[model samples]
Target: MTVIENIVGRVTVLRGGRYSVEVDVITSSGFGRFAAPVDENPDLYIAEAHRAVSEVDEIIGPELIGFDATEQELIDSYLWEIDGTEDFSHIGANTALAVSVATAKAAASEKNLPLYTYLGGTFTTELPVPILEFASDSEFDYYVMVRDLMEITDVVDAVNGVLSNLKEATVEGYSEATEKASSELGLDVALGLAQKAPMDMEKLLTLVEDNNVAYLKPMGDEELFLELIAGTHGVFIDGEYLFRQKDILDRRYYNALSIKPINLGTLTDLYNLINDAKSERIVPILAEARFESSDEALAHMAVGFRCPAVVLRKDSIAKLNELIRIAEDLGERGRVITFEG
Candidate 1:
């Protein structure tokens, strides 16, 4: 009978020094690696990491060591049971997600096939358009290295560049720092905003209109979140930033759903959210589901959902390469994506 041979957990820092929980699972046939998301607050994240590490070593490791790894339903049910809380506060959502994903990865690794294939990936040639981000000429130039950039504005000549529009591009102090970088390059690229600060509708709408912001990732109350940016270019619901599930009950309010698997607390919840969004014609974004390692990447990718886009951070080749590899494995060579820092 296939069983978990051993489990190991470690706390590591992700890009920008965010703490994360990394987990590894080994079975007779293969191995798996996964990690939990981190918090920006160092102290809070470190505490969560320590808790996860302790749980794995003292409690979780013993309970599931002899359990069959292939039996996903059984394992996940156990995960739900252990957590008790709907949001997985007890067992730590990050730990639970890491384990669930690692188990799936181990099973796939044993087969020696792509994780997407193992998780029912359909072979298709259709490619999703990728949205590339630009900060400077150097950043823009590097977009081609990624192999699937749609909005790479690396071809800016000095004359046609921002010189003529220098006054417009080089504003005194742009509220949106992201826009400042790309806008300075004078590329015909659209800008997006994450309104972390609260604002009235008039002010928010005017900001969107004046800046010609292409999308809004609002962070605040449900009513205000929707009010500030809905029906604009596109409204993407970022639970990490926005933090309300009930806010998305209405289908017409927003057209895109973005999430991290860790934030959802379980694979089941993540899939349910994706399916619901798809049914309602809302774009399902596997965006910001930051799987730091290859195993986490495959486990999440193998769910067999061809998303509208998956956001990739522009920090490391490892991250970008992993994303590209997942897309290729799923026969989705060009998954729609927007670059973020």
Candidate 2:
């Protein structure tokens, strides 16, 4: 048995000088580390990171000392019980997730198994398709949905060509630009939008219709959410607004949902949500928080969960590079997932 010996947390400074908590879980036979980045205001991120580390060293670490690292469900339950909060507001969700994931990694190390193999079993080989978001020099953002990354010899060059066309095209001409780039680069590309604020429904619908946007992350009231689903034709509506609302799946409000580990609080919770989404025939896309660490555990989780797609930004190269390595490791068994949405 791999018994938990100690848990240590340190403040880690990420790119752009952002702060995150790096957790080290030490067990009787192995060790694991994970960095938890919180989605907080830039001004308060440093303080939040420090507080999480302090909570781990003084509170969570001491309580979990004698627990078995392999008993993931029990450890996650204890995390909720100790926090005594419905939303993990007391201890913070990022802290709980860090501890939960690190425990899994520790147990995997004890057995000399890869993290994905430990969590997903021996036959998990399919890699999720990368949903790469590129922002042009003109500040226009679009997504390149690669059908098969292994097929592309130079992904950077292909994406550069896509961005160049996007820079010259107007918002109304985005669909044409994407289509042109797709034909020239021989890649399946699509337009994507993330709603940061409320917009007129007519305007939103017009943009979606005109640009042929295939992916949307909308944030608004239930009416707006339902309207987007109803108005668009074959658009992949990501359920960012519907996080933790599994009941909404029954209504089929969104075809896909973004799974962020920090929002779920623990690995058990994240796993349950992914299973719930799949059981409902909804696609689960592993997504990072607005702010993130360089940790590549998320890439492993995407493969482990068998998620079809991963929504990642340009700066998330660490996760992308990790996916490439996982693909190479899987060899002939590795294939990009077909995006259903």
- Candidate of highest TM-score: 2
lDDT of candidate model 2 versus the reference? 0.79
lDDT of 1 at 209: 67
lDDT of 1 by residue, 194-224 (tens): 4545567776666666763544655556666
In the range 43-109, model 2's lDDT, one tens digit per residue, is 5477778998999999999999999999999999999999999989899888898999999999999
Please state the error at residue 141 of candidate 1 in Å: 22
Per-model TM values vs. the true structure: 0.73, 0.91
Off by over 4 Å in 2: 136-141, 147-158, 244-247
Candidate 1 structure, TM-score to reference: 0.73
Model 1 residue 148 lDDT score:
24
Runs in model 1 with CA error above 4 Å? 45-48, 124-188, 220-247, 289-303, 327-341
Q: lDDT of model 2 at residue 341? A: 59
